[model samples]
Target: MRRWLVLVSVAAALAGGCSQAQDASSIETTARDFFGAVSDEDGQRACALLSSDARESLETGGDSCDEEITKLRLEGGEAGRPEIWGEQARVRMGSDTVFLTRWASAWRITAAGCERRVGEPYDCEVEG
Candidate 1:
């Protein structure tokens, strides 16, 4: 019974890990499309890449993804596409590391720092 329990636990761990990896890859693709849109400086198109809450925030909460993109563009602009892990991602933007994520196929910029977080700015930077 103990051996069976152990096997079950292992299987669960493996399944969960695989799911996380798939989510990460999906996030990576979303991030690529998002930053690609940003590189083009299309706020509306880029905003389309953001989650609905993020979009609402941008439209109503007085948040500023455009400015963030512009600042990133000025600070030498983004270095490369983000590498996502689970619901989080990291990107090098000149001298800064930009945090990112995917919310329903939309890419949201959630943080800007060296180390990465796991869960608001951690959850998405493109906050309200």
Candidate 2:
């Protein structure tokens, strides 16, 4: 079950629509860019893709916190394409896994209701 989820998530991340280029890689790329910005401590850029709560967390926690999040990389979850029709996205970077969302063919990081770990490698939430 987990493996299937991984496959689907990866497929979702890599594809998108341009009309919209819905393939898993497209979404993954969005996640990749977003993470890169965050790692660079570009909160404004990262926040642009983050959920409302994520934005709030960064606002309250400040630059240090945001930079920490940025450090995480978007690893796998690509079957060489992108697909839409989902509210969430997942990708792996090194030993890390990231969750993102879809807006048409565009992807953004999901921060609302997602549990964050301070000074730790993972900040994730299980979908209910």
Candidate 3:
């Protein structure tokens, strides 16, 4: 989860956009698109939305990223309010929380299917 936090922080920092509305909208769009790709079973598209580290983590054990990612069977839900701070961002949906990082000019998913755990880092299904 430390890895997940770091990634979120990076993106949140970059999220210092011209306006809060724009930043939030961009972040929300990325989150929705990521989950949408997952729900569609379009592993290639879903993997494209991931941060480099996340893609690396998902492609472990000699499996191709597209193949392995599809197997995760992540659930998609309606996006809710996003919590943004510095360089980290967490967007909560009805069923999942997604962590994203800003890499260059785009936002990428660092973790997904996350749930808060008391006295612990988020328990995430997909993380870097």
Candidate 4:
């Protein structure tokens, strides 16, 4: 019985590790797609990847989300490994950092074009 319990514990640990890896991969993919859309000038596609609140934030100035997103000229390059915490995640790219939240079954960008400031919260070009 003790051996069986030990085996089960190991299996559970492995499973959790796998799940974390999967989540990280998904987060990176989402971040990359957002950057790709921005680089390709596909405003509609990029906007679709944003969280609802983020989309609304872009439109708060009476400008369309698509138009505003494009105008920001957000820059990103190869995505680094994502740091995930429950439903929230942060991915750093070459020139920018993006924050995301898992909504439903997909990851959506909550903030993009972020830069770290000493002793302050990240300043983002687009945030909800």
Note the clash tally of each candidate.
8, 36, 9, 0
Evaluate all candidate structures by whole-model CA lDDT and list the values in order: 0.58, 0.54, 0.84, 0.93
Best by TM-score: 4
Candidate 4: worst-modelled 10 consecutive residues by lDDT: 60-69
Write one digit per residue (lDDT tens) for candidate 2, span 3-98.
999999878766633334444666667666665665667756766776655555554345543554455443323233333456665555444455
TM-scores of the candidates in the order shown:
0.54, 0.50, 0.82, 0.95
Every candidate's CA RMSD: 6.0, 10.7, 10.3, 1.0
Regions of candidate 2 where Cα sits further than 4 Å from its true position = 1-21, 61-85, 111-128
On the 0 to 100 scale, the lDDT of residue 47 in model 4 is: 97
Output the lDDT of residue 19, model 1: 72
Give Cα distance to truth, residue 53, candidate 3, Å: 0.2
lDDT tens readout by residue for model 4, 5-53? 9999999999999988988998998989998998888989999999999
**Model 4 segments more than 4 A misplaced:** none
lDDT of each residue in 1-128, candidate 1, tens digit only:
99999999999999997876666555555555666676777776666656555555545346465645433442324356557666667676555555666665545655433334566334334453
Q: Candidate 2: minimum summed lDDT over ten consecutive residues — where?
A: 74-83
Better of 2 and 3 by TM-score: 3
Model 1 pairs in collision: 49-106, 109-125, 109-126, 110-124, 110-125, 110-126, 111-125, 119-123
- Candidate 3 vs candidate 4, lDDT winner: 4
True-vs-predicted CA distance for residue 11, candidate 3, Å: 24
Best by lDDT: 4
